[model samples]
Target: MNIIEKHLAKAADLEKVSVGEDIRCKVRLVVAHDVTGPMAVEQFAKIKIEEVFDPQRVVMVIDHIYPASTVQARNMHWILKDFTKRYGTILYEHGQGVVHQIISENHAQNYGDIIIGADSHTCTAGGYGVIGIGVGSTEVAAAMATGTIDLEVPEVVEVNLTGSFKPFVTAKDLVLTLIGRFGTDGLTDKAILFTGPGVRGLSKDERMTVSNMGIEMGAMISFFADEDKDEGVAQTVAIELSEIIPVVACPYSPANIKPVQEVAGTEVTQVVAGSCTNGRLSDMKAIAEVLRGKHIHPDVNMIVIPASARVYEEMEKHDYCKVIRDAGAVLLNPGCGPCFGAHQGLAADRDVVVSTTNRNFPGRMGSREAKIYLASPVTAAKAAVHGRFVDPREPSGGGEN
Candidate 1:
């Protein structure tokens, strides 16, 4: 059995399992956030259950649309607060951080643990060597009530990564390159198992960046395997990290990838560097490295957001946040800033944005008429300073140095 099968079998108390087989398995953790938690709580109420299956295993995060921008969002927070109070479930309130980041910092400690969340980026936990699956609010509610989830074992697509990343090239570029090779839905309903010598090249946070965007390719889950598997996979694709350059996903699709050179000089109205995708301390350092001793372009509005409060504190201790702010970037509270297009940094029609967030779908960051280019933290920071996309590796890329 492969890594997926091995974990599933252990969770299901079975000796063996097969791809495409339906099974119910116990989960170590279940997560929901403000955007989905309200809906999940609504569904849980429908189940007529008095308490959650295991309060310790259930977590609710009020990060997305946090601080209550509207009455409706505030009411949603009230729902989650009321639910958590009644059921004794753990809740990370406002200013805590993004849901996936919170989970990674707090709950994803053990390998081979089964984790499910209502948000697609829940796959971010896979960086911890756990099986992290994203599901709908209904499914999350069911999992909360029953402490188990039924799933059809997905066919595995092995991503064999080799080589090391070049300077200014990062996991975001690698994942974008993969999405470019295989269209958005190329791996629909499949599980992507990362393997090969290249897996060792990425730090845990870099691995999280890779896993966070797997859902953009329509993968059910994307995780790093503890060991290499030579068989039982539906397909295998190799990625040479050394050959990858800074790239971006063009408007309306995460798979519409292009080299930064191709899009250089395209004016951008906003630049964002925060999300489950690249909002870690390393990402902040990348942004600060470019912004230090220079302010962003007068035409560009830059927003820097940390992934968690702890990350924010570390940034302050390291002076990354101070340098970023001194460079004319607006530092917002740690949360899902402008990633879901719910609020904060909404682009106007005809606006162009370069962001470190995952997904570039129409209206993903604001108006459908606005164009969003998804890139790495370094690329996004360079764009903010240049007021357009520029190759970070080139001395002639032309930005305020």
Candidate 2:
């Protein structure tokens, strides 16, 4: 078996391994943000849970409203603070960093672990070979109480990305292209296991970009290279560390396969960059490089939001903020924001938005009539400048530095 398959088999084995015949099929790590934590705390109170199973296993982060965007947001933070303190849990405020980043680096997400977060992009942990799933606030609270959560073990579909990515074609573009090829009906109720030589060449950030969007296809979990093969049984379920060629999957049923090049040149009305999927520092740098000296087309409203204050700080430190701002892109905070249409940058009726976000389901980013096209940071930036979906490899009217 190849590296990915080997690790997956180990993950399956760990799921079956028993501690004195008490089979632990679902090993869980619970996560919640300010927006979702308040609700989770309320649910925990409802259940009358005296104490969490493991205080160290739960992570609470206040990222959706850093600078406290509103009175309601401030109250949410206050409630979260009180709740974590009562449970003797770790409460990561604005200073600790975004939930995704902190969780990725946290010791709790070791290989073969099943992690569940209230945020949809929680699957980002798959980059490290853990099976990550996004759950509702109530589900999160239950995991905190029971130390386990039930899940339907999903069938795995292998996404074989073969060829090397062309210049300007990033992991973001690969996922978007998958969505365009399969629409929203593909890969429903499946776990996407990204394979192929192409997938092995990607960085951790790039891998996160791909797995984080498994929700777009309604996938239960997305897994990549395993990291635990060398650490004996303890680390045997971790993703294999290797170079991956960037690729995306659009699993339409169990038989259909399509490539993004087949649907290039599609038109769009808006272009967005940022969001948890493509709001990392590398993603922002790619956008700045693509739109350095160019201005966004008047017809397209380009919006850029960093995933967290850490990402925002990195952009400012690297001067990426100035580059994008000067190019006429509207910048927003680190919250889920436009990805869910919770605040500004809502889509118009029947409008198509080319975004760097994960899902594009009807009404995901605003108007139910609106359509969202997922792409890489580079593609979104280029499209924003050209007023249309233009492949980043193609020359623009005025080349970006």
Candidate 3:
């Protein structure tokens, strides 16, 4: 059995699921963000479900709409707050950070444990070796009440990775390259089992980037193997990390990818360096390494959001805040900033923005008329200072400097 199968089988032994040819498992935890939690809470109300099975197992984060964008948003936040208190569910209030980041910190993945979230990128929790899957608000509600949900045993695909990434190439770049090859709908409903030396070699933080974007290709779940034990899954695709180049998902889609060199020097109006996908301390250190003592371009509007309050404190400890803020970047309290264009910064019509966020679909960054580019934090950091796409491996992109 492959890793996914082994996980499901083990979960079946827990009360989470009963193992049969037809397997449906109980979710270990149910996580929701502000943007999606309200509906789930409303669903819980509709079902007349007043009490959660275990409040400690549910997490609600208010990251998407920071500081409450409007009166309606504020009211919704209050409703969520009330819900958390009334039911005893864990609640991370507005400005705490993105859902995925907080989940990673608090819910360390357990082997074979199944966790799900309302947000698609909840698969990101797989970085810690859990079977993290994303479901809708209704499913989240059900999990909150019963701690169980049915899952389609995904057809697992083995992504055998070889070689290693070089200087300036990152997990984001490799995932982007995979999306470029597989297209946006590439992994549709399939769980990608990452294996091989490449998978084992990646640090936990880097693995998060890959698992985070698993949904970008429409993946059901993306995770690395704990051991070389094969789960009898026949399908496999191998990726050579050494062959990947820094890539950007051009505007209007996450899979419309091109190598950075292919679009190098393309002008950008705004550059953002933060998101659940790329807002960790490792990411911050990478961005600051390139931006040390250098100022961002006058034409560029840059915002750097740490993934969590914890990440923010680490930045202060390392003086990364000084290095980045002094370089003219807006340092916002940890939350999902402008990644979805909720607040903090929004692009103007016809503007081109490069960001570290996972998605780049139409109007994803506020204006439908504006374009968004997706890249690694390092690439985004370089673009912020240069005001255009530049190869970070090039001399002008601070590759050697």
lDDT of 2 by residue, 1-401 (tens): 43433444444454233212222344557899988999999999999968998998888988766657578879999999999889988888754456887677555556657788998778788876787888899988888888777554455556666556656557765665555454455666566677656666788889888788777777667787532122112112112222221222222121122333434555667887887788888998988887787788888888887776777888999989999999888887775666666655789886778777766656777787886766667667777887766545555523334
Top of the candidates by lDDT: 1
> Over all chains combined, what TM-score does candidate 3 have?
0.96
Query: What alpha-carbon RMSD in Å does predicted model 2 have with respect to the real structure?
Result: 5.8
List TM-scores for all candidates, in order: 0.98, 0.79, 0.96
Best by TM-score: 1
* Residue ranges of candidate 1 with Cα displaced over 4 Å: 398-401
lDDT of each: 0.89, 0.69, 0.86
| Local lDDT at 19 for model 1 | 88
Give per-model CA RMSD.
1.4, 5.8, 2.1
Residue pairs in clash, model 1: none
Candidate 3, number of clashes: 3
lDDT measured at residue 354 in model 3 versus the true structure, 0 to 100 = 92
| lDDT accuracy of residue 257 in candidate 2 | 24
Tens-digit lDDT track of model 3 for 214-271: 9999998888776653556658787888888888999889889988998898999888
lDDT of 3 at 11: 67
Residue 110 Cα positional deviation in candidate 3, in Å, after optimal superposition: 1.2
